[model samples]
Target chain A: MILTVTLNAALDITYKVAALTPHTTHRVGEVVERPGGKGINVARVLAALGHECVVTGFAGGATGAVLRGMLAPLAPHDALVEIAGTTRRTIAVTDGTSGDTTQLNEPGPTVLPEEWTAFLSSYDSLLRDADAVALCGSLPPGIHVGAYAELVRRARARQVPVLLDTSGEPLRRGIAARPDLVKPNADELAQLTGSREPLRATRDARRRGAHTVVASLGPDGLLATTPDGTWQAAPPEPVRGNPTGAGDSAVAGLLSGLVAGLSWPERLSRAVALSTATVLATAAGEFDAAAYERLLGRVTVVEHTQAASGK
Target chain B: MILTVTLNAALDITYKVAALTPHTTHRVGEVVERPGGKGINVARVLAALGHECVVTGFAGGATGAVLRGMLAPLAPHDALVEIAGTTRRTIAVTDGTSGDTTQLNEPGPTVLPEEWTAFLSSYDSLLRDADAVALCGSLPPGIHVGAYAELVRRARARQVPVLLDTSGEPLRRGIAARPDLVKPNADELAQLTGSREPLRATRDARRRGAHTVVASLGPDGLLATTPDGTWQAAPPEPVRGNPTGAGDSAVAGLLSGLVAGLSWPERLSRAVALSTATVLATAAGEFDAAAYERLLGRVTVVEHTQAASGK
Candidate 1:
């Protein structure tokens, strides 16, 4: 079973309108609601991939209740902790005319001291039955900065392979705990390493204590530096669609492949394919299955023989 | 006791931001949630006015639960019918920089046939114990176009004075049922009477079947045509703020004043004062008590010397 942790979950709502104009009233033509957070999104994709996954997180208030109800049927196991504060919500107003979207994110609730303690205990207990764990998204208010680092350390202590997907200080502190995998996009990589060059940034990330660092280069695909070797993977063609959850789909692909004992190249191919499929899907946090299957074989993974062959 | 019906109750959510830009992402600084619908807003003000108000309508799903929870301590009584469909939410994005607001209103939930029957039964039962009833807002889908009209007839059959506040076909049909009172703003009045002139339009609306008609004239205050006579009541000066629920506040004042056995001039003074106070309040569906008191004495009410005087 796979384990996923999301400290800050959201009820993702999308409102479709003819157009969005500032200071004007718009009657929404359609409303779409779903549960979202990086880890929750990853778990959704992983479940679609035929993996047994358990989702652990904090959920409270009306928004949280709606999210939990929606997630009940999606995830195999739910280990969400109850909190006193309300969960946040994100509204994506999509204009039907220009196919543009405006995002409004509510600030997450503050986690109480006992709530964080309770979450830590639950996460530790959930890790006992997990094959691999993925820690995803930003930390909600009142949570420690080194929260990911502590989780990564705990997962390692339990001999569980963990993947960390976050940015800024969380990613920096998390990598120092030496997680098995870390996937950071170019902007996050540049923020962490202060290097505009993808290759240099990717290598510098791995040296920061991450066992393996996969830097997502947006349209250019992914550059991965690992103990075995360095590899570059790219989709045959860029898929044009909503890119909101493409990275989470990539994390799902990589995490699922690791649990299935797929090689680094195979994982990279699957990750790139799933990400492109997610981009092709019309709705956010969903992948085009047919596209994923078709692109899986079309994805190209090449080994970089110039990099250090520590293996 | 006052019975107010909001067939399409909503969970009104407001998001505060520094600025609003279309097709751009924003982080909301704060969120404020409340129960809203025309009648619900009226009930809120009536409850604040020390009236025993029983609110009845349809409420369902998670949004309904949240709305009911927020309204439990608000209204004197909760008699909202349960339904299968989820209640809708209205989002108001307030831009702090320009003091502008962008509104996004979700279409109300469709009322099931059985649910409509249930509401009618509950409303009839509640009206038996009521001095007056208010049938408010747009009819949700699946409800007959004459929904308000039917409700008005029922209230009249029980000798319960009913005030209807709606627009378009609903207002046209509801007025023909001879509701005790109908409050239509300038636009609704014009649509119903096909007359641009306020005095002529207000009189025309009364001839169509409403016992009395009160036309809200924006900054021009209110024009009332009733059995006693016609009168114009205006605030001393224009009190500027959000006008979202100003009319609903007027409806509350009118109903409450009628139940308190106030004279026409006194009722008009209270209505105009409450409406002005609602505008003075920073938040919607709220009246400034101090301003209401101050403005109550300052409001001017003069009876029209030449008008329909059958009374």
Candidate 2:
């Protein structure tokens, strides 16, 4: 079973309105809510792919209670820690006419020292049974920046394959623990290595202690610099829709491949195909199964050494 | 004791950010949530003034659960009915720099036929001990348009004074029930009686079956046409801040005075003073006691028939 951790989980709420005007009132046409955070989204995609996944995170107050209840049916196990502060809610107001979205994110519940310790204890027990672990999303307030690094170290000690997906200081610190794989989008890679060139940034990220670096190039696809060698995976065409959970879907693809012992090229193909399919899906973290099946055989994975091999 | 009925209650959420721009992302700096709806706000103000208030409405789902828990400490009694649909959340994004607010309100939970019948049963029992009843806010979906009118009739059968506060067709139909009092803001009154003139609209509303019609004139206070005579109450100055709950505060002031058996001029004075103080207060549904006390003595209630009496 894959274990996923979301430090700052949220009750994601989307409001549909006719139009959004500043300083005016709106009568929202519809409201949709779901459990959201990087790890939760990844777990959802993985579960859809027929993987048994355990989700652990901090959930508190009324919003947390609602999120916990929603997660029960989506994931196999719930290992969320209870805390004092209320879990935050993230809202997206979408304009029905234009499809323009306005987002407002709340800083999540602050973690106390004892709460962090309690979570660490829970993590230690969950990792014993986890075949692989994915640590995702931002570090909540009051959690040390090295929280992910400690998690990576604990997973490594158990000899479990761990994937770190985060940005800024936490990502930088987590990389130092040398996780098996790290997925960073273009901007995050550039911010970490200060190189606008994707190839150079991915290489530099790998040199920082990550065993393998997979850089997501948005609509283009996934680029990986791993022990097997460099490979670039691209879809047949660009897909357009809400790109919110595309990266999480890609991470699920890569993790599933890792556990199944697929070649790096095949894994990159699956990641690119799944990410594109997620963009085409109606909601975030959900991919059309038929679309995924059709696109899987069409994805082109070219090894850097082999001059542009076609599918 | 005043009984306030909020057929559509909500969990009001406020997000404070630097600015709100369409199609962009905002990291909200602060979040504040409270139980809200027209009657809930009025009951909170009444409770603040040391009045025993009972609140009843439809509160269900997760948002409703959160609202119910929050209302426990604010209002003395809770007679809210449980329903299948979740109560809605209203969001106000306040720009910290410009102090401008953009609001998005969700259409509240739809009440089933059985739910409406259940609420009426609860309302009938609560009215037995209520000194007066205030029916407030919009009718949720599936509820009949004449909900307030039905409530007014029931209160009248008990010989209890009822104040109907709503707008559009609901207000029009409710006035025919001859509620003892109806408070309509200038726009609501204009829509009901097709008159922009405050005095004419108030009189027209009273003639349509209401025993008393009080029209809120924004910063100018209230104009009332009642059996005693015509009176206009004006505050010393226009109190300015967030005017979100000013009208609810006025309703609380009026209901408090009616139950205490105050004279018409005194009731008008209290209503004007409390409404102005609410505007000056920092948050919605909260009034400064010191400000209310100081404004009360300065509020001038002029009897129109007395040939324009001045302070």
Q: Which candidate comes out best when scored by TM-score?
A: 2
- Candidate 2 lDDT over residue span A133-193, tens digit each: 9999898898999999999999999999999999999999999999999999998999999
lDDT of 1 at B153: 92
Docking class of 1: high
Model 1 alpha-carbon miss at residue A155, Å? 0.9
Residue-wise C-alpha lDDT for candidate 2, range B183-297, written one tens digit per residue: 9999999999999988878888988999999888889899988888999999997667878899999999999999989999999999999999988888866887899999998
Lowest lDDT sum, 10 consecutive residues, model 2 chain B, at B302-311
Query: Against the true two-chain complex, what DockQ does each candidate achieve?
Result: 0.84, 0.88
Candidate lDDT scores, in order, read: 0.91, 0.91
For model 1, state the Cα shift of residue B80 in Å: 0.8
Per residue, candidate 1 scores C-alpha lDDT tens digits across A1-311 of 99999999999999999999999999999999999999999999999999999998899988898999898887557788999999999999999988799999999999999999999999989988999999999999999999999999999999999999999999999999999999999999999999988778888998899999998887788899988889999999866888889999999999989999999999999999999999999888799999999999999898888735332
Candidate 2 runs further than 4 Å off: A306-311, B306-311
Clashing pairs in 2: none
Regions more than 4 Å wrong, model 1: A307-311, B307-311
The window of 10 residues in a row where model 1 chain A has the poorest summed lDDT is A302-311
**TM-scores of all models?**
0.96, 0.97
